[model samples]
Target chain A: MGDLLRRCLMKRTDPDAPQKRRRGAAVALWGVMALLVLWALFNLRAIGDAFVQFHAFLAYRFIRRALIVGMLVSLCASLLGVTLVLKRYSMIGDGLSHVGFGALTVAMALGFVTSEGLPAFLPQGLRGAVARLCAGIAANPLPFTLVIVVVCAFLLLRISEHSRMRGDSAIALISTSALAVGVIVTSMTSGMNVDVYNYMFGSILAMSTSDVYVSVTLSAVVLVLFALFYPRIFAVTFDEMFARATGVRAGGYNMLIALLTAMTVVVGMRMMGTLLISSLIIFPALSSMRLFSSFRAVTISSAIISVACFALGMLLSCVYSLPTGAGIVAINLVVFIAFSAIDATR
Target chain B: MALIAIQDVTIAFEGTVAVDRVSFEVARGDYLVIVGENGSGKSTLMRAMLGLVKPRSGRIVYGDGLEKNRIGYLPQQTAAQRDFPASVEEVVLSGCVNRMGTRFFYNRADREKALGNMKLLDVERLRKKSYRTLSGGQQQRALLARALCATDAMLLLDEPVTGLDPNAAAEFYEVIRSLNRDHGVTVVMVSHDLSGAMRDAGKVLVMNRGMDFFGSLEDYRTRFAEGMVKGHG
Candidate 1:
């Protein structure tokens, strides 16, 4: 590790430095990506058998849903991660995921129960309708959590922009406060249930059928918005003030980024959990940056790296009985280290 | 008509006056240099012209078919851009963003204009290079090309040569001088290197939180040169 650090910090005086190193790094990165694909191809049947052993009923459908949603969310996270990391807004992703967790907890507390604890003066017919509505919300808390998290994301953006507090400090203040609310609400209402534990650490079983639909729709929206506004995002990320002077509406784009980030976090947190979803937005971008020097290269490779990492991690978790979120994070960390080592040697 | 008219501009930030009631006009094909000490509101005034900041009690009237966003600008380098991962072409192409309003991507015309500006700035060879890999002068030239892609009417440069070596600074000045003389472009530069910056200017505005002196270069040389020399020495 010390030697790697020295290699990273020291400037190489090779006669053919930039081009040679750039090519070498690209080769190393693509080699790893190709290896992941070949490995997945070779172990396809084994992985499928392991999934069936892990879950009996609807195992194939569950695995398919997880792959589709997980890969899409990871792609969105990595693409947006390039801009977020570049602008030093990675912590904003972290904060929003925590906010998502908090909102989910609140949603669970508010919606997971029936309308039984209502005031005694309720009418009979109205009481039945209310009870039915409560049951619907109890079954699916995603919409409630989505609304709350999106609002908090915008609030965080405004606070960071207008307040005297630094960006990270504002994030810390809001995230920690939301976390406390979530914990207190959990202790008082839910009393540490498996559902709450699943949301905190993530489990494949946590994904409802409705979650797959929301994740797919929201991920598609994110991908479309990102593609449509790629140039503006690049201009804004490069020099916001300059972009503003050129009439790019930098503030509006910033709001757009915040909105997209909130959506991505809420959807991704279903499988990655609140504690580890942020890694989906951080590791791939950082690793891609280590090996690529151009924005387009970094962005494209980051997306590929993220999807590959998610797929591999999901497979490993299925075969080995490891937690899905931790497994994905471990795979991402390994890729990051591999890229860094290649970069150091180059 | 003047290209840009600054009428009694007063700007304040958080209750502190950064630019007092200052006024100036930039005519077409004119080369104007604003000289000032630190905190003298030079940059603030320029930003107000660019519509990045609003004046407390004034207006910047644009004429000669000039709009706020049409003017080219070469702003000071920020720390974020020092290690940014963008090709020179990408950075240069972004200068045409204002004109591509509501359009998702740059059109063929924008590409041609970017290439023309890159060639004009002698950075066409480095267009494919990463922006962060260029030398300081080359980076400045790349940014200048980007600015040129925005408009041919005027250029607003803020401290363009602050950290450049003397030779590179001279080359940059020559490029600007050619742009003003040969291409008939209006140039407004903010600088502290009074000696080198004042040499090719037709007018000089000496700023000290307001308009201290606004007149021709000859008048400035006669009236303010000795005082400035003594002050600095």
Candidate 2:
């Protein structure tokens, strides 16, 4: 029995023993990759048929636009998600999206009035420019919504940090108020009920070409800013007070996070809806955190997971005639659960 | 020459005073141990020295070439902070942020300094480990490594041994004593263990919402002998 126990301990401690297990893991990984390639090849014809059907459909242009917007939104939201989730500000995304909803409703109401006609007191050129701007805002409310939501997000952050109200309570108060105002404004505005419904429960098929352009431009801005300030953001997320003590200007980094989140929330609201958009920011980060320990690793994994899940969700929705927002959220939920299970087993 | 001077500093929250009319001075190479019960503003006074809070009145002035960024601070950690998702190396490397001024990335010098500090703290082998997985003693050692990387001039620790076992705490105290004695690093430590702290501290500041006593260890022991017995009783 002593000899057997010694042998068992030697086997466990031998470094070369894990080499065999690693080889097995490598083989399994390659096998999975090969199977995925084969499956893609086998489904090529069906995918082609789906594409043809999509193109022949009346809303092909809208579908293309929605796809572009969805990809951009998913990328930015997931990138911002890692820091926000770690900093315990995950719910800020939800609050800001509701604020965007309220702003969208107000913009819609203003657009309706502008289309009816500007007052004659305005000069000719100024009238034309104002009319064009109002018309643009009416067509794509994201820019206007972005401004309102960013301002409100900053306010909420300040209130939470400096006021007697706690963080969660502040977020709840702001989000619920914005939601109530949005519902009231939507009811008050006549003839835009369908438009409001589309915003509430996103209609990807209703996205315009300009929406795609705006989303791409804003996503590029967010990506560039995030890359430039990655180090500062990491410091702030880990310990804001410590970061401040080290002269890193933690508050400035926090403002940048709020700004990025606002932009992501606005862009995402078109496809994920105001109510469901925060899931795009929350799910991927949480899932990646289960598997990766470092900030950089978790961030990269989150981005990949978010893009993959969004693509899968879009494809499933297109093939099965499902609600786009709900489909994406459901896929994210599954991925989160799978990740949690894997982490538990490990 | 004094390294830092706190002149009649008063810190308050809302309408309540936390530290009132606190005056103290830390001379060069002094090991000052601040002892107080909970809610006695020991941590608040330290924070004031670090410039974390604006004093309601008076001022904290630094001399002897010490600057705000050059002071290493080991703040009291909460559970959530202890569980921050970062590797030991990453946490230690962040101490270089002040020196890296306007630079986005840490350079080779910063990396060498971080590694050296890790070696000094005997945490070099755990460089790649996740900070959250470390035991209490190891985590404090890692944080000490980070603080050392920040500056060699001085260290200000707030309850650095709160959760450490007796042996771990004793080891930590030895490490701190060597840093002060051998390396000549000024230390301002806030601690609850007066008996243990009295062994190494050059001066002691006993506080209870105000300055109960501020003098050398021998003078403090002699001045507060009856009070200490009554308090313990």
Candidate 3:
């Protein structure tokens, strides 16, 4: 009786282990989210009465938009990322992320971002004034920046296309170069921008309504594409020779993968803050696979876990004045460490 | 009908030629085994014919109704794939992916075919087991079932019996023989084992970096033990 009780108390992490822990963690995670929503609702009077009621409502809309967009982008990145990591293409993911950072940096300095691109969400007078101001003082070369990022991505992708070098190595080189360029460009344009820090680590609370639509639509397309090309992706991920033999054309599939990675990375730059977005892509896949078997299960579980964490992380940021991106990562790390420990003990 | 025809094939990696102007033709219901020592280009030639490796110069022509979803290839198992987390059903189902083309979902027929192939291979009970958890013989059988899903036209095995015990190897060859004799599927396999590989193979092609001979298995056996026995030095 004593031994049986000890065994019962000890963790059992077989196939059902994931479902059990997953349910518990999910409940706890969402419980926190519920509390956060309630707390935010609780503080509604404070926000509405003090601030420009417009700004408060605007902030609320922005958070909602950011939540939608951030989750969608993270979902896209994660789906592609699981395969890429399995094929040892994390470096490529990294490089594409740098490409995103490069794009963001340029957009901040030279693009119509003097709040000009702020959509119709802002009043017309402020929008027009910001646009005109952007036209005047913007020093970052927007088109050139986009061009540079593209060339860098293509060059790395092209080299990795033929050679057997792991795509990660090429990604590492390009991403590093991009980050340095981003830093240099930022320093050069200090007097010209409003929030370099915001670009570095996304201020999710600052997102606009239009961003949500863009995220939802783009992410849905990515999910559909993955489903459509599951065979090609699975084949290439596991064995290239066998995959080719089965009629998965290599060149086209490889390029499409690169393109998807780029799109997800770029779209996520605003929410994850270019530096940490890939973690969102990677963590859930690894965590899901820790107990699940099917790729479908892993992918779905990843999305579910990601959305949950993001929601909780955002709420935590709102309540405690924590960095949103960092807070999300922290929560993810804690979950990862907790599960890993549980797995280890068992 | 000749299922596979390769002519004047030359393969080089970097600057070293692995298969020099090798050529062969395989017919329906034929079981042809190519045997050679290590670095003798058996796998290179096999891959070249399957379009896995592009020969420096060669043409591989397949008969009509036999080019698409008609060739099932089994490459040597590397440690990486053996440890992959997958189900036997999932592994076998991938074979039918070629037939799915650009479609998003595989229908019931494909699933039944995958299941039927696993059952035929006598591995139906192993369907739910993690692919990595299976033994070598089981893994090979699972892979064979996967290939069987893609086509009944031709099954190509690259050193399938290399790591198996004699009984497992014999059992595997029996499946190959049945696949050919019973189903009219053509079989092309690469082998380094002399005695076992020759059991059911109707024709034998011997080579060491080039064509050695193409003749009946009995002829190769009778001609065996000569320095360039069957012209495969």
- Among all candidates shown, the one with the greatest DockQ: 1
Q: Sort candidate 1 into its docking category.
A: medium
lDDT of candidate 1 over A98-178, digit per residue (tens): 888888777777665554677668876787787777666566777777788889888988888888889899999999998
Arrange candidates by DockQ, descending. Answer: 1, 2, 3
Pitting candidate 1 against candidate 3, the one with the higher lDDT is 1
* lDDT score, candidate 2: 0.83
Report, for every candidate in turn, its global Cα lDDT versus the true structure.
0.87, 0.83, 0.74
lDDT (C-alpha) at residue A96 in model 1: 91
**Is candidate 2 or 3 superior in DockQ?**
2
lDDT of 3 by residue, A60-104 (tens): 766667767777777787787777666656677667667767666
**Ranked by TM-score, top first:** 1, 2, 3
**Retained true contacts (fraction), each candidate:** 0.56, 0.43, 0.40
Q: What lDDT would candidate 1 get against the real structure?
A: 0.87
Fraction of the native A-B contacts that model 2 recovers:
0.43
Candidates' chain A TM-scores: 0.81, 0.78, 0.70
lDDT of 3 by residue, B1-233 (tens): 57788888899999999999988888888999999888989999988878878889988788846884468989888665865657777788888877786676678999999999998999999888778778888889999998888787888899999889888888888888888898888898999887788888899988789887788987886777554454343
